[model samples]
Target: MLWLLMTTGKCNLVCDYCGGSFPRDVVSWSVKYDISKLKSTIETRDRSPTVIFYGGEPLMNPKFIMKTMDSLNATRWGVQTNGTAVRMLPESYWKRMNVALLSIDGREQITDKHRGKGIYKRVVENASYLKSLGVETIARMAVTMDSDIYEEVKHLVELGVFDKIHWQLNVIWSERWDFENWAEKSYLPGLEKLMDIFMQNLSQGILIKIIPFLGVISAHFTGGYRGSPCGAGYSSITVTPEGRVLSCPIAVREKWAELGTVNEFRLLEDPLPDYCKTCDVKKYCGGRCLYASNEKYWGEEGFQLVDSVTKKYLRMVISKLPEIEKLIDEGVISKSSLIYDPVQDSTEVIP
Candidate 1:
């Protein structure tokens, strides 16, 4: 099982997509439950689970992270951070981490525009620093209208600091943009070009770890995934600061998302809706995202609009399978190279 421990609900930067920290009313700024209780609860469920530190900015409570890591006998330790406070937790602690996901949306201009000025540089520097320590560093991007997916992703790949790159479209929870126009005009076209680059890299014996493509393609060979690809309600769950276990981490305030308290938690029988099970691409997409499907943040029409992107993305990746197989057959790339992100370390496979 994958356990996402919400270290804190406080954040230093207010990114445009998420709008910074959760309200104190929704989630406490600091942890309210005892650390020993969390450790005991987790031990009862799974002796050595994969633990990932999550938050408004997990680094805000470095003490909590260090304390929890010290107490829990986790199989792996990972953090989804904004990359500003990498130094807060010393090098020794960082070297122990299995993965470190840094949020930087492509290039300096785009990232700074959304996150704030100087955030891009700081994130890149921290990513390089983490990479130097032999930690698996991932450049996580939140794609939006301002983003040119192909260019931004390509730029980050060229940086050579990150071990992998993952992106999620900013579609859920907030009516902010022209989804239809942006999808057709920018995102879809950018994805086509990005797919071309992905195949080119594969043929040249280089796996440019673009997770969305790699994850979906991996599912194609592994008989596909059920429920959420990220395992929101199935294999993965979130522990809030107040000790509430949520099916989806971002579904912070939704009553339906509240599974139970950490001390006495039970998994939902069927977190996904019936419509997801009946979808033609359910096998490949794995219901896209559990929160998005349930919330319907964009209404049915807008929800399907986002779903169209997933369908198109699925087709694009599936279309390249033959060539990818050819590359494998010719010894240009190996099958294992395509097998990535097996565990839900905060990489929502279907962007």
Candidate 2:
């Protein structure tokens, strides 16, 4: 089981897409429950669970992170941060972390446009610093309207600091953008080019950790059926600062997302909807996203719009499977390189 521990709901940066810190009412700025209660709850459920520190920006409460790490006997420790507060936690503590995901949306111009000026530089520097400490650093991108997926991913891959690169589309929650237009004009085309780059890297015996491709391809070969790629309500669950357990971390205020509390954590039996079960691509895409599937914040038309992109993206990857297999057979790339183990790392494989 994967435990997403919300260290705090306070975020230092207010990005255009996420709209900054989570409201205090929705997710409290600080943890209120006793750490022992969380320890007991986790221990009772899974013996060697993987605990990932999550938040509006988890680094805001470094003390909580340190304390929780000290308390729990977790199998692995990871954190999803904006990269600004990496210094708050000491090197010794960071050395213990299994993974650290830093949010940086591709290139400097695109990243700065969404997440303020100087954020790109700071995130890259912090990623390098974390990499230096032998931490498995991931460059996590929130793909937005202005993002050129291919260029940004290529740029980050060239940086050589991150061990993996993952991205989630900004389709859920906010309805400010013209997603339809952006998908057709920018995103889809860039995705095709990105696929080309991914294939080229594979042909050259370099398996670039472009998560979306690796995840679906891995599922295709392994026949692994997942309800949600991130395991929101299935293999993983979130513990908010207020001790409220949520199926998905971003589904903070939604009543449907509320599973239970820290005192008594209960997992949802059938989290994915019926439509997803009937969908042909469910096995590969894994319902895309649990929150988006349930809430449909973008409405039916908008939801389908995102679904179209997902379907197209899936086809693009599946179409290249024969070539990928051929490369593996010819020793161009190893077959084991396609195996992606970070299913519960909030990589959002479908995006």
Candidate 3:
């Protein structure tokens, strides 16, 4: 199904790095649905696609949110949010919602370190509370340079919190955190450690659902998620808050085409071109992160930074197959759902 990012551009924190925080309170959803854009998407429904609640923090303006959701007749609804706001939502809101994903990070120390302290704890309590409330909670952690990943991950699962955990290695901007001559909270070395831990953990036969990082490997194993040479224009399309449509989320802001809005309901009719199909890494990679690719910060440092990270990850996954098999046989893994968590109590191979 198609994915509609039904969100207003507003967030609590001014994370200098995050794209969402830009232009400051841009889409005043309380005033109106980005009508021009919203109408365009709504009029062209993608066969009853899903409307994902992307946000600066969706709950920031709850009044307009219900109205916005009411406008969407999506076949399914998914939301990504920091758990803290969930508490503000009443019991009725929870029972009526078809909650898809709940985004929260690792431990108290690391998450709070990046997202703000005590934020991590509230997220934990929130995620656990959601699960207790019968909403399947998926833990989403953005692994960054400062993350003590294994340690953080271990703690989350070990605490017996969350229904399922998902992780994405933070895509450090090559321009901002380039491998060469960079010194601001960079984690090139730590990422290598993470790859090693991945192998070690995978050898133990547990799997973790990592996005983008495990892209090609995941594609191959799953038979395919989208398409080969799959850049946004090909396999997917993204719509901005202003109703600007583009090939992908990473495309230049000004280059964004004014596609119809969620209210109008039109999906991108065209797919990616021959360039995508012809690329050597198409079947495997689908092309690297577009946002990172277009960066002028690193200049030629792009390949050096991204390729190095991808290579280590791919190699680690492939080499650990035998160990993976043993872990599976021993019942340590179930459906590729574990990560390098020395902190978890240990994958339950036995009842």
Runs with alpha carbons beyond 4 Å of true place in candidate 3: 24-31, 34-44, 96-105, 172-175, 178-217, 225-241, 246-281, 321-351
lDDT of 2: 0.87
TM-score of 2: 0.96
Give the better candidate number (1 or 3) by TM-score: 1
Clashing pairs in 2: none
Candidate 2 stretches greater than 4 Å from native? none
Give the number of colliding residue pairs in candidate 2: 0
In angstroms, what RMSD does candidate 2 have relative to the true structure? 1.4
Which runs of model 1 end up more than 4 angstroms from their true locations? 342-344
- Global Cα RMSD, each model: 1.4, 1.4, 6.9
Candidate 2, residues 1-351, lDDT tens digits: the string is 889989888999999888889889988999999999998888888977989999999999999999998888988889999998899998999999989999999999999999999999999999999988988999999888888888899899999998889998888678757988988888889989989988888889988898888898898778755678788877889999999999899889889888889998678787667777887777787788888888888788889888888999898889998998899899988878788755446577887
Question: Taking the tens digit of each residue's C-alpha lDDT, what string does model 3 give over 1-351?
Answer: 435353556666543236444454444443343544563455564555545555566666565456656665655555567666776556655654555355455767677766766777777777777777676566777666566555656566577766455565455452244333221233444445555665565666644433323443444455442332323443344455555454544342434333444344234443423334555444444334444444434555554555555554454545555665566677876535532221011110000
Question: Would you estimate the TM-scores of all the predictions?
Answer: 0.96, 0.96, 0.70
